[model samples]
Target: MAERRTIVSGSTFEEQIGYARAVVDGDHVHVSGTTGFDYATMTIADDVVDQAEQCLRNITAALTEAGCTAADVVRVRYYFPDRADFEPCWPSFRRYFAGARPAATMLVCGLADPRMKLEIEVDARRPG
Candidate 1:
């Protein structure tokens, strides 16, 4: 059987959340929903676009830590507090996802934190 591994991004909520930031099972890497909050500062950015960019940055950091890259991402889930936030940031999202056109979903929902405007989760794969 393939070994299972947990990838922690050093978030303080790991204990409460009861999950790692990512997990590696053989060639597959699954990343958790990442928010705009800077884990180090425990603060969320104000602007929606800035928040989206930061979320992707966090996702990238997690992917890298898991021995994967954005190019390897096969799926992505985006959560927005409002649909209006999506329009201004489409360009930024396009740039980040330029090479890897992963299957994606975007939804509007309430987040745990009121300051958060967007969150993203990614799934990546490496060949066996």
Candidate 2:
């Protein structure tokens, strides 16, 4: 049987929502949509760019715990409440994903929390 594991960031949202932050199944890691709230203090930034960077930090932590890095990412999705907020975060995205250059998409949509300017989800494969 293929090995499977779950990685948690200790965000109350994960327990409240009943979902793991990331799941390691065989060679693939599927990270759940993660927000900008620092799982430690549960505080989020007011600026969209700052929120975008925090979202990457949150996702990177989950990926690390799952035995993969952003460089291993194969796909990524960005969700934003405002399309205008997306451009301001491009530099942050480029910094994190320049190497992986993972397939990417951005969507404008509502989030669970109005304070959440952006959410990010990623899929990665462990180097074989």
Candidate 3:
């Protein structure tokens, strides 16, 4: 049987949220929606672009912990509270995703927390 692993970053909220950083099933890794809040500082950045960048950072950390890298990402979903915020952060997003360029979706949505302007979710695969 394939192993099931739960990725946790030692954050209490992770348990509260009832989700893991990533779950590995066979060759696939499914990462949950990650926010821009810095888990270390427990704070969210003020700027939308900065928050977006931080969201990617959090996603990267989660992926790394799951024995994967940005290059392995096959799909990405980005949630933004405001569509206008996307323009300013497009460059940063492109810079980070230049190599992977996973199938992506960007949308404007009301997030769980008011302080959270952006959230990122990803799916990755380990090469056979």
Best by lDDT: 2
Query: In candidate 1, which residue pairs get closer than 3 Å at backbone N, Cα or C atoms, i.e. clash?
Result: none
The TM-score leader among the candidates is 2
Give me candidate 1's TM-score against the actual structure.
0.93
C-alpha local distance difference test of each model: 0.86, 0.93, 0.84
Candidate ranking under lDDT, highest first, comes to 2, 1, 3
lDDT of 2 by residue, 1-128 (tens): 99999999999999998999999999999999999998899999999988888899999899988888889999999999899999999999999999999999999999999999999999999997
Q: Score every model by TM-score.
A: 0.93, 0.98, 0.92
Give candidate 2's whole-model lDDT. 0.93
Off by over 4 Å in 1: none
Candidate 3, superposed: residue stretches over 4 Å from native = none
Winner by lDDT between candidate 2 and candidate 1: 2
- lDDT by residue (1-128, candidate 3, tens digit) is 98778887655578797877778887899988888888888888889888888888888888887788888999988888888887888898888777898999998999888988788889999766
In candidate 2, residue 65 scores what lDDT?
88
lDDT of 1 at 92: 82
